[model samples]
Structures are given as C-alpha cells and as structure tokens.
Target: MDISDKATEREEQDRDIALHQRKPEGPAATGQCLYCEDPLPPGKRWCCTACRDDWEFIQK
Candidate 1:
C-alpha cells in the first residue's frame, strides 16, 4: 500500500482499538457490567473474564 493508504489503514485500526476500549459511560452504567449486568468497578465495561468473553463473542 502507498503511504496515504497505510496511514488511513492505521488510523482506522486505531479508531477500532479506541472503540473497543470505550466503556459504558453514564449514571445507569455505574457499577454495572455491560455484558452480564453484574456489579463491577465503577467505570468498567465487563466485570470479569466471563463477561469480557461474552461481550467479545457477541461482538464477533
């Protein structure tokens, strides 16, 4: 790929990574797991390994 193409690809990949790391942000999501609805660290997406796997499964 050309320089511009490679740059675009990298940018897209970075955006995807950022999106993947983004957590549920709101008062409602506070202390709740995004995947299993369990209590979690205040700003976390998945509460545990199981919840992370479940979310990754659904995403895929």
Candidate 2:
C-alpha cells in the first residue's frame, strides 16, 4: 500500500521479466534440412513433414 511496497513489487516484476528474457528460447536440435540443406534448429526444425522426410531420405 505504501511507496516502498509498490517499489518492491515493481522491482520484483522487473527481475522476473529480465529472468524470462534471459532464458533460453527453446530446446536445441542437431540435424540438417534436405531441400535447402541448411542447419536444423536454426532453420525452424525442417519447416514441414515434407522437409523432414526429405532430410531423412537424403541422409540415406
């Protein structure tokens, strides 16, 4: 209810936001695209089923 409480709450919220922002975006993957032949995780994980299957086929 007082200014100190409000400031503390704001500080906590800011810390939470910073923590989330610093967290890793998502899981990592190691693979390659077939058609484009680009890297995997960096390429949004193949884009589609076709791309994925194509990658598998190419691997063979």
Candidate 3:
C-alpha cells in the first residue's frame, strides 16, 4: 500500500480499538456485567471470565 493508504489503515485500526474499549454511559449505565445480569463491583464491567468471553463474542 502507499504511505497515505497505510496511514488511513492505521487510523481505521485506532478507531476500532477505541470503539472496543468504550463502555456504555449515562443513566442507563447499570452496574451489571456486560454479559450476565449479575451485579458488578463499583468499577467492574464483567462478572466472570465466561461472561466476558460471551460479551466479546456478541460484540464481534
């Protein structure tokens, strides 16, 4: 690819990474696991490893 093409590709990759890391926000942001309905800790997002895996699969 050309230099400009490579730069565009990198930008797209960075956007994808940022989207993956972004979590839900707002009044709807309940303190619950992303995959399971279980409650999460103060700053937690997943209840267990399995739930995390399932959430990732769904995200994909």
**Top TM-score prediction, candidate number:** 3
TM-score of the candidate numbered 3?
0.48
If ranked by lDDT, best first, what sequence of candidates would result? 3, 1, 2
Candidate 2 residue lDDT tens string, 1-60 = 499999999999999989955736433344655456577675355657787677667667
lDDT of 1 by residue, 2-52 (tens): 999999999999999999777564234467887878877765766888877
Please provide TM-scores, in order, for all candidate models, with all chains considered together.
Answer: 0.43, 0.38, 0.48
Candidate 1, poorest ten consecutive residues by summed lDDT? 21-30
Candidate 1 local Cα displacement, residue 30, angstroms:
4.3
Highest lDDT against the true fold, candidate:
3
Residue 34 shift from truth in candidate 3, angstroms = 0.9
- Please report how far candidate 1 places residue 43 from its true position, in Å: 2.1
- Residue 45 in model 2: lDDT: 51
Model 1 TM-score? 0.43
Please identify model 3 stretches exceeding 4 Å from their true place. 1-29
Model 1's number of clashes is 0
Candidate with more favorable, higher lDDT: 2 or 3 = 3
